[model samples]
Target: MSLAPRVVIVHRTTEYEELVARHGTHGQAAFFLGSRGRDIEEVAERHRRTRQALAEVSAAVPLTWRQARVERADLDRFLFAPEDVVAVVGQDGLVANVAKYLAGQPVLGFDTDPGRNPGVLVRHRPGAAPALFPSVHARNTGADELTMVEAVADDTQRLVALNEIYLGAVGHQTARYRLGLEGDGGVVEAQASSGVLVGTGTGATGWLRSVWQERGSALRLPHPSEERLLWFVREAWPSPATGTSLVGGELAGPAGLRLTVESERLTVFGDGMDTDAVELTWGQTVRVGVCGERLRLVG
Candidate 1:
């Protein structure tokens, strides 16, 4: 006899639920929102709809499969097995949040409200879980293999970013760092900038696009499924000890970027989760490159 395949549904607390949890009651939450010129009823309705969608998905799971539900906040601590299929029940960002932790498992992203959250990642409707499960179980589903960016520090501590990786001062202020890139040979430069951004093809439209807009470059960005990555040094200052020549470029094939922390403290975080970050002191080196694992997202 074989064990039943497990389905893990990932979700987050709705706005109304969070407000009530913090305020200890609906009355207090309403009062707080009313003072801010926000209507509590709107939030409450959204919460109601989100719960209804989740309930529908729960009811649609196959009867023979084992099931579990996880909140977004608790994903860092939750243990996932090799045979688990992840069902993300939230906006697109939630899919990125969960992508870094997965290796080859198939992910089904369900947008609770398609009207408000128009997403590229979360394409399926909540009620589509039952129809989506069989293909995922057989591993022949239509999916996109999204590349990821990785930052390895001291060769041990590392972070895999599904969207992009940020490296800079702990406060994101202008800081000092020795930046190096591996090309045909090798190039190293010192820079005084706000920070550095390394993003994957899937992230080109997000923060990477903003950075590209500032440069006004004519170069085309990578597509969402490409095996390439982009790097940009934000606001590189031309000073006596630093230069701005190697500010932006593409990293492909065997090329990568290295940063030596010249400031008192530097932090490296992935997918905009600042809480789950690695801190580096002066003289520490961190390498940013393509990750070995990829995100298998079912459409």
Candidate 2:
């Protein structure tokens, strides 16, 4: 007989929990929020709802299957098995947070609070887990293969994300690097700017959208299921030493955009998680492109 699949339920610590931890007590947390003209009950209610939803999802796991619970902060340390089914019980961003860590596991996104969340990735409610879990385990469910972005450094450091990847300096200062696009002739430009951002269709609805809006209709962004990637150089500074000719473009097929670090130190982070970024030194090259591993999202 085949081994039973493990159900990994993922969630993040809510604002109320964070506040209480920081303040050392619920009353202190309430007082802190009150001073800011905010109500602690609002945060507590959301937290309560999220916890309740998590409990419901957990209870829906099959009796024969192994179960695991992981917090967002512990995802980096979690070991996901090949036969594991991931159930994310949080907001849409939580789904993105957990995507990079997964290989090709089917993910079921659960929205604890409906109206508050956009329900883009987390489309289902907690109650749906009872029916959805069996379908997902049997591989009889419909799933969307969402594209993801990846960044690989010369040193073999690799990072993948569902939304986008950011490469820039470690501090507030401008990042200096040489940019080149594969298959776009031998042309390359040295640039000084805020940094570089490469994203997928899923990312277009997030940070990539802001950059697209700023440039009007310069390039068409891809959809969530499109097998393409978009890249943009933020605030490309033109000076005697650097050129701004290579600002932005699309990456398709086997092509990738390359950035060679010229600054003392640079960082590559994905999905807005700056603390877990890869560090790069001068003379190091990092390539950004569409990732081969797609997020198998079960609707």
Candidate 3:
């Protein structure tokens, strides 16, 4: 007989904890809130709700299965086995953070505040967790398979993104790179722009959408589950050495988008998190493509 699936709850730090960590003490946090015309009680209440929800979620897990709790900060170091049924007890972004580490495992997203924070990814509440196990365990759970983007630099550092990947200067300065877009026939263009954004259909409504809105493209944006990817070179400038024609397009199939670093320094980060990024020096090449792994999100 097969063993029970282990329930792994991934949670992030609460608002109160963040305030205390930033201010060094609860008293200091209160003072800072007061000075900003904010009530410390609000933060306290938010933290209270978060903790209560987490407690309820923990209690809801059935005793038949093994359970493990992982904080968001420790996700990178956590080992997720194939049999693990991952549950995220935080905001929507937390689901994205945990998605990259997973290898086709079923993810349950529980929002701490479902009223104020209605999430697309984290659609379920803590109260629903207990009832979800049977279906999840039987592998009969309804799920959305969200496409993810991957960025590989010099075949050394590789990072997967559920939303979008930003490739540019660390500070959003002008980024210089040889932009290569793969189509029926490969086309490479030397260009200077703010940066490049390679996003999945899951990210169409996010960063990619904003970029498209600003530029007003006639092409249709990708749907959440689409295997295709969209690339946009922000503010591509016209120079003697740089071409602006191939600023944006769709990338699919084996040959994806490639970037040869021409700037003194450039960094590739995913999901708008810069701290976790790959810094590329001049002449380094980074490839952005669709990640084979898909996020099996149980709504």
The candidate maximizing lDDT is: 2
Which candidate do you rate higher for lDDT, 1 or 2? 2
For residue 84, model 2's alpha carbon misses the true position, in angstroms, by 0.4
- Which stretches of model 2 miss by more than 4 angstroms? none
Write one digit per residue (lDDT tens) for candidate 2, span 153-266.
Answer: 999999999999999998758999999999889788999999998989998888998997897747888999998888888999999999999988899868899999998999
For each candidate in turn, the TM-score is 0.96, 0.98, 0.94
Model 3's TM-score against the true structure: 0.94
| Clash tally for model 1 | 0
Top candidate by TM-score? 2
Please report, as a residue range, the 10-residue window in candidate 1 with the lowest summed lDDT: 180-189
In order, what lDDT does every prediction score?
0.87, 0.93, 0.86
Q: Across residues 1-299, which tens digit of lDDT does each residue of candidate 3 receive?
A: 98776999999998899999999999999999999999999889888888988988888888888899999888888999998999898887888888888999999888888777748888888888779976897888888998899988895899999989999987889899887765637678898889999888878867889998888987688888888888888999999999998888887655588899998999988886777788999999998998888999986
Against the true structure, what is every candidate's RMSD?
Answer: 1.3, 0.9, 1.7
Per-residue lDDT of candidate 1, residues 102-206 (tens digit): 878889988888888867888989878878887789887888888998999984888998889999888778879999886636678899999999998888878
lDDT score, residue 294, model 1?
Answer: 90
What 10-residue stretch in candidate 2 is worst by lDDT?
Answer: 212-221
